[model samples]
Target: MSTSNGMRPETPETPDHESWWSRIGTLGQALTALTGLIVTVVPILVATGLPGQDSGNSNFSPTVVPTTSQPYTSPPSTTPPPQAEGINLTVSDQLTDGAEEEVIVITLEGSRVATLHATREQPVVSQRVTATRAGNYSYVVDAVMRWYDETGTEQVTNATGRGSVSIDDGTRLDVYVHEETDGISLSLESATQ
Candidate 1:
């Protein structure tokens, strides 16, 4: 039926429902964009020492490595399994149960080895550290205690201990950190393999 204004009968507008092919085309475009992003990111990650980078260089100096050993075949177990030559250390903190402590960081660095963190906790500090070489090693144990002064503003008391340990092939030593009236004392219990 025609209106008095001379307009034709109108049909209701239909909302557009995307078709399967059109959806697939959109998915293909997204996939292409994602592939391009991944392609661009991988080289950057490799260059920046990220996931895709190699653990070490193949052309490392021959003068550095005097001996050649076979690669490790299996995964490492819980206990420190004995290797041909290495030092395995177990550090135990003998501080009083309720002693004041905040951030504690213990490190051992020297002689055929880099730095190793023994403890980074409170109340108690215990950890297992393994090093591939055996020689004289120096350690730096640092800790901080936080407390409120008379004015109620937070204040910190820091403590540091320096010591040395001797290690040999396939040696295992237990280091005890004992708190004394003056400061912390580091003593070696014994050595074993």
Candidate 2:
């Protein structure tokens, strides 16, 4: 008489195969380590101040872009051949000195009538445009400057001023623009200043 055994006899492990229990244990350990790493690194990333994280009450100021257009148009004169009409306008840039990266665009619309491109070092005067009518023409001068700030964002600033110039024969309408800490300032050559 012999005792009955339900299980089969054990055999040698396969040459290139891992044990199933051992593989499962290793995978579980690796998953746990990955979870631990994420837990450790996430706090560091947040605390060290990653970009695009807003606290809801941010003081960042939005950029300001300036636009220019001539709203007032004078009618062409029906004067005789002996009479001609037009205003001579000139723009002088007196901003900061030698700012190579700064791009300054000056737009003259209305009376003076010329768009001038200038920089800190170079000032430009536009060609004289013949006036269609003879009167005190009101014009708008807009100086827009663009530059790259330290944060790698393109920063734009604008200076604007309105002037009225009277022209009959050869009116040398001159305007000056300057950059100040508060903003831009403009002056007319005929101004009392």
Please report the candidate that would top lDDT against the real structure.
1
lDDT of 1 at 106: 59
Q: Write the per-residue lDDT of candidate 2 for residues 52-136, one digit (tens) a residue.
A: 7764546668765554664555568886678554444443444334333333333334333466565544544344556665566
- Model 1 steric clash pairs: none
lDDT of 1 by residue, 1-193 (tens): 7888989878986556665556679788789889999999988877666666574766656444334586545546687677665566665554433334455455668332222222225444556667767777777666555656677776666666677767664455454557789866554443553
Best by TM-score: 2
- Candidate 1 segments exceeding 4 Å error: 1-85, 96-98, 110-122, 147-155, 168-193
Backbone collision count in every prediction? 0, 3
Alpha-carbon lDDT, every model? 0.59, 0.57
lDDT of 1: 0.59
Superposed by TM-score, candidate 2 places the C-alpha of residue 25 at a distance from the truth, in angstroms, of 98
TM-score of each: 0.35, 0.39
